[model samples]
Target: MPREHPLLPIVSLPFRRAGRDPMTCRYRCANSCAHPEPNASSTPYFGEILERSLSRRGVARAGALGLLVVGTAASTAGPAAAAPAAPPSGTTSTSGGRPGRPLPFEAVPPNTIDAVVTPPGYQHAVVVKWGDPILPGAPEWDLHRQTAEAQEQQFGYNNDYLAMLPLGTGGRRALLVGNHEYANPELMFPGYTGIPDAAQTAVMFASAGMFVVEIEQVERTGQWRLVRSGQRPYNRRITTTNTVFELTGPAAGSALLRTAADPAGRWVRGTQANCSGGVTPWGTVLSGEENFHFAFVGADEAPESMKPALRRYGFDTANRGGPSAELIDERFDLARHPHEANRFGWIVEVDPFDRASVPRKHTALGRFKHEGAATVISRGGHAVVYSGDDERFEYIYKFVSQGRMDRAKSRAARQRNMTLLASGTLYVAAFDATSAAEIDGSGTLPADGAFNGRGRWIPLASDTTSFVPGMTVAEVLVNTRLAADAVGATKMDRPEDIEPSPVTGKVYCALTNNSRRGADANPPADEVNPRNANRHGHIVEIAEDRGDHTATTFVWSVPVVCGDPQDPSTYFSGYDKSAVSPISCPDNLTFDSTGNLWIATDSAYALGGNDGLFAMPLAGPETGHVKQFLSVPVGAECCGPVISSDGRSCFVAVQHPGEITNSTVENPGSRWPDGDFGKPGIVVTWRPDGRRIGA
Candidate 1:
């Protein structure tokens, strides 16, 4: 295949999308859980102080899966059965088998090491990694002499969320955008020096952001390499140290976002803590800035009235020890610059095709710890985006754009359509348990026997109106969780990644474990979050009324209560309890073209093993059959799993391998993919025979 002109670089264009509505397609909101989970693959973010307000805690151990859950049903039996992908529509058995003739592969047990473990017939490789040159004129990586200038042009650190959109609609070339959630200084720097000098801190600042690059498939093979043509035009990096982002929606110029530098509050210097994100039909990528407040300290000297809001956001003025960000950037000292914290936690949008375009933060979608955004078109053509606040006890939200998706691919048309998210109606979820009284604060089924419910998307604010009394439209968008609280949204068990099924039009959310369930250190178990002190979380499946993407009313049920099946508390779509792979702490989620749901786990609590990826059929005979496709290294959390357009290759971002107690660059626990210092990167796994991934 012949390649066209090299892709253009990311140019920064400025346009306020607030009123730009010309029937162009619009985008939606998304967020990622930037703050690392306890003893997670990375370091601290907002940390546990926020846990107080979050009012939550426990996860199942990674190993000892069966020991944790005792007396339920055995999942790993003596022999195994063939599990095949159920036909998109058919009458297949829940325990799928036989018709296709052979099973894909048996589920692999959890292991502790540093390798991209895959099925026998599959092959894998590292695509792009930290320190690799991505832009023109970038110097080769030199660990001993690292600098912000060099880090800016190289791949940013801690690759988390990623999106691969076809380049020019061609199958051979595609653009990949990955979110560098945050930098692991200990792992990056040679001697493991703490954040001390300005030079080193600048490196940290430059590494914590996002990077966009183009990739091409090898001649007639599944292997893809970074397009190495003259200065990759589309290759660029958006970092906390330099790139500028424009704020959109109701809160664009709000006083709360105004800083000494950006008094207009319409633009911020950069986006930090970007986590898992989504792709829009209009051809742009959406990234969620999560726990951006982690880098700052709360304002103790601010007006008393503003204290509660600051604390609610996990901001505290107390200096915990060691070199602090406040020493370098005053904006981190909330007492000196309080509003700077408000500028983050919004779903940010970027146009991958045009490097010159400015990234945008859609404030209409509210501010919170976002797990990221996923969108689906409504029956009426409206763009409906789904996002979950990654904090435990927070709520899941959806934004319905006023305008419909404009399939026109012209540059002008796409620009106009991108503003759809800038102005829309945002709603929070509220669940009504069918069996309200049966919940006895234990991880038990209600009188109705299942943790099922009827729920409604409570409208919190529209682009122009605020449903919450006393708050303005702008205020509602900025203080979304407060507005959600005021309107009685359901407090979930650490709502994480959520997505709508392309084939079924149903929405699924990963409620990462909230140790604070029944006696959750706070609220008791509700029908939606039924487990008491839920160690292993569950998957909540939502079906909008009449399959409408923007439907206000919906029905929901717990499809998979995760944990060791032997433990009496687990549930897996009521399928044979003995047949499912044990999974816990579901984080990022995505479905293949065939409609099979692929789940990436953040915490392997139940099995005491490395976190891994699981594939479950969402329709027909294999609806609840969960199979472990692959597992990451010893301490890495699997993230950003996206299937190539052809469905022949699946790429998963292995974040922070070798992250463990006492593990650092000098003393690595796992030097995976490359045996040296631990680095976060993406890995592509494909079948040797060119079959579909997970086949």
Candidate 2:
């Protein structure tokens, strides 16, 4: 038996507040849920595979015709996103089903807690909060007296997507890189109404970007703190207000990317709306620019030829009257600078070790509403990156660098490896389920006992080369979503952070909930996404062909269909339902040293509880056993989960606490960590005895 935790009670609220707060939907993602899905292409779902598979010879012949030839203008005519003809039909395999190690900690129960809840043996601390003074000579944070200059020197708001890279040996020091995804003006400004003034807007822009701070481990424990002492050279702030980022790759100097300010199109001012990211093997970081469509105005008045690409990227073209960043920067006004919108939405690379290093945006990675960039080394020594376009009925993407990684430790070698992402071939995913005939959109398991499938990576573009027939290299890179749609890629349900396990090369993606799944002509439920009106999303496991990261073909299966275990719709890799904890809305994903999957949740209140972090063994007897490791504060979503290389500390970014509708700084809904206001911050959790996490 477990003792009851003395915290906030589990209050029953209406289903409306269960998922995302209306205020969060507006501020975080520009009320994206309220708008129609940008991807309106007539792409076929997995159910079409059954109809095509009736004739093996015809299916094989069509599969070959479906794949677009890379490095050339070879292409397909219609909606035929089939697999390569060489692979066998319905070929799939499963892993991690045997007996293995058991989870040691007890699960935490769901609650509307105003504090961070952890398993009994584990402990947690607030590592750093938003608006803390990170740079030297920076004044303390005062919500009422905030200025853009002061905020530029302080830690920004809404810390998300955190990673701690080793600074030196012995784990005593490390560098922490995090993203300030977006700003919540209602929560930041006291007595705030709608549409902030120039000063307030400037402060908000200054608060949104990326941050790098030096952190030191405490006494060999998992606890770490920001270095507030002498000569912290690594403490730098890259905000949307002033940071200059360089443009790289084939699309860098294209006419579409050029603007009146530069004309050269070789440089950009800043990176905004950075979500989740991954630390690369070459000792740098790659952050994705997400939800950038909300930052611009005058798109309705843009050039006639540009309206299609703009609307396809979620731009509000019909509404010309709205307050946006155009007031601060003319580049945001698409009517005056239609080409400026093309500059953002690329993968940004930052070298944290060099203080004077100018960050670069790689154009080879197709531009979209990127969730994050996770990289792995392929069997053929190429750099493979996986990213998700986070929107309803969007597609997943991959990039394979043509250049091999330089393994030498010299600075010259590091500089050479930095250019790896600048030239790569971009591909999109298309799935074909084996059990398509049994999918009834009711979350029922097929006769094969699992939702498994076969899939392929459809090439879209390469460096200075166009695989898409009509689009040029620059057009394919800038208008990537359009090219993917042209190639008939599979539309997924808000694919978020995608990661490849360090222990196993298998890739895992969090297909976060899509309320519109099967609702009114949206893509119906298939094997991978096995639920209709999927409130609690599921996890996907993909094994590349021949264990090669750059392979075009792969096998996939849904290991966990997250929801209440009592619900017949939920599936947990054949685990005992009574033994697993309920999980909803899986978002960010990471892995432990032993290959256990650590999942961070966003908008998990759909299950009538606060969002939380969960751990599930990927293989063995406990493979599908889900355990709740920690629960965030009320009205908050968990993001940017990273485990230390030593396997002792786990870091999570708590974002947008106390963001309930109509709540302001004057009367906040939940006061967490500081007892005064709800501030988004990074937290570190570990065992008191300093044992390996989840040991």
Candidate 3:
């Protein structure tokens, strides 16, 4: 049975008091501390100042001067203006209804293939994978010759999120940020046991993590390959053992985050099991900490008072020894690092431009089984991020920062903007699906042919205020689940990836799969969920009130009910069911240049085929025109599914390629991307004719 933690605690941290005198340097000294004022002058490069600050105190003269100018300008600009009109909605259409001819290589085979395959006319290749030499002088991987020291320097495992940022002037070189969700010991170890074996455990531990590599585009082939030589300055790795993360935002350094390793509550040892992520307009990567519960053990022995938040985050409350404990750090042992579990579930930000940069865990976003974080510019120019806690009966959340974004992606501007997620307001969703009066346990369309309704933002915390009334801001952000519950937020069906439509300003959330709704204690079906015991979930479209992401009210609708289209309970916005591909357990989502939504599936039920990537024209007559584009090997889930800005290339993460019950490396259930043995990896697909992907 799934564990249910109580809502997180809520406490408020007062903003720093204003300093006396206009010319006094109020900037504090700390590696992860916020600037006293947004306008305080700062050095040209934030990385340089941060490094200097880590070694000593005092602000750089140049930085202070720059801040002065910014502060002066901000003071004159006054408060931010209201949001502009939303962009017109795009047309939804069937896959066959598009005017352009379909690419011959748009779909691929359904097999447990050992190589990266694409449609007939498309090209596919590996961009990067676990243990690939990334940094300078990094030794090549030797499967049997693994070491924690070497693993910390090489690319990590289970690449889930992919983002390529162009480097230099011509865009030939780029930096790649990928998430290492978790390691499959059966595939990663030479000999493995579910039981804890120190040596075997070390190898598995080293492999379970995230990687940041640098690569350049091969001009002739339009393929991307790792830059194996040169400084490759941007290449780095964030693993489970050595990487250090700074805490920021509302819950930063709060009592809940205090641990023996970080009694100051300012830093964490590493980033574990990162999953789907998003890129900020400022050129930074925002990675979600997903499935973090599995990395720890002994939640059952934690102080009784701490169990609620643990249960809310999916930690086993009855058993102190969690799944595969012997393979993980003993700090996970509540007997040791009692507060360790509290450190794993926040959104982590990495600035790829600074190779020596420390990734930060932003606490204002709240903690849960985060799948992905998507950002959009609010009417106030503040950054608004949407996230989902991927669990049955979990909730969807959003964070709006106090600082505005820098529209232009300059180095200095990007540095300033990267701090946007540090301080903000966090909210959970509470919806009222009124369009469907008779939604009753069936996945049927409402009388209006939609599961649409109004909704509220249900504020959890804002800068220094805890909206739960009885809770404090720290408690709200640290133990946010509790605060969300206190306010009666609506429970969702395993909300997975929540992303905003860059073109529409509306947000889309994938409610993956839920088999608990309508259960004795669970909530009954509503228009939005529409079905009790939802198996294959649906897509939710939310239009923020007045198109302002910071608004507390909004309108929502279920645009797509996922399942075999032939199922009467399922509806595809009236599109032809026979023409659409069946999809289940929608896990990750991405949008193409044309605004079509691409969905990747995990755990396809009764589908009788490998999980695959699918695309649908979210707007036109083919709005429900879902088509399978590519499938992963048996037992593997298609994740990431990132389409480049130009739409020329699509990258997907083939996770746990050979995952299977009782499967071992010697007798793998599925060998993929490599014929000998399957190593989960990231695959890049591009059109041979040089046209945009999915065109």
Predict model 3's lDDT versus the native: 0.66
List clash counts for every candidate, in order: 42, 2, 42
Model 3, runs deviating above 4 Å: 1-117, 322-330
Which numbered prediction scores highest in lDDT against the true structure? 2
What lDDT tens digits, residue by residue, belong to model 1 across residues 457-479? 99989977899999998888888
Q: How well does each candidate superpose onto the true structure, as a TM-score?
A: 0.84, 0.92, 0.83
Best of the candidates, TM-score: 2
lDDT of 2 by residue, 1-695 (tens): 12232344335433362288788888878888888889889987654766643333232211110100010000000101121111110112112222246778989898787888889888888888888999988999988899999999898988888867666545577788889999988899998877788788889989999998888988889888888878888889998868889999899999989999979999999999999887676667789999998888899999999999999999988877458788788889999999989988989998877768899999999899899888777767688999999998898999999999765555676677789999989999988776678888789998768787678999998886799999999999999999999998988988998987543467888998888888897878876788889888888878787778899998788888898999999988899999998899999987665557788998877887888899887766777889999988878889888767666888888999888877789878668868877899988889989887787
lDDT of each: 0.69, 0.80, 0.66
lDDT of 2 at 430: 89
By TM-score, the better pick of 2 and 3 is 2
Off by over 4 Å in 2: 1-18, 53-99
**Candidate 2 clashing pairs?**
18-605, 98-620
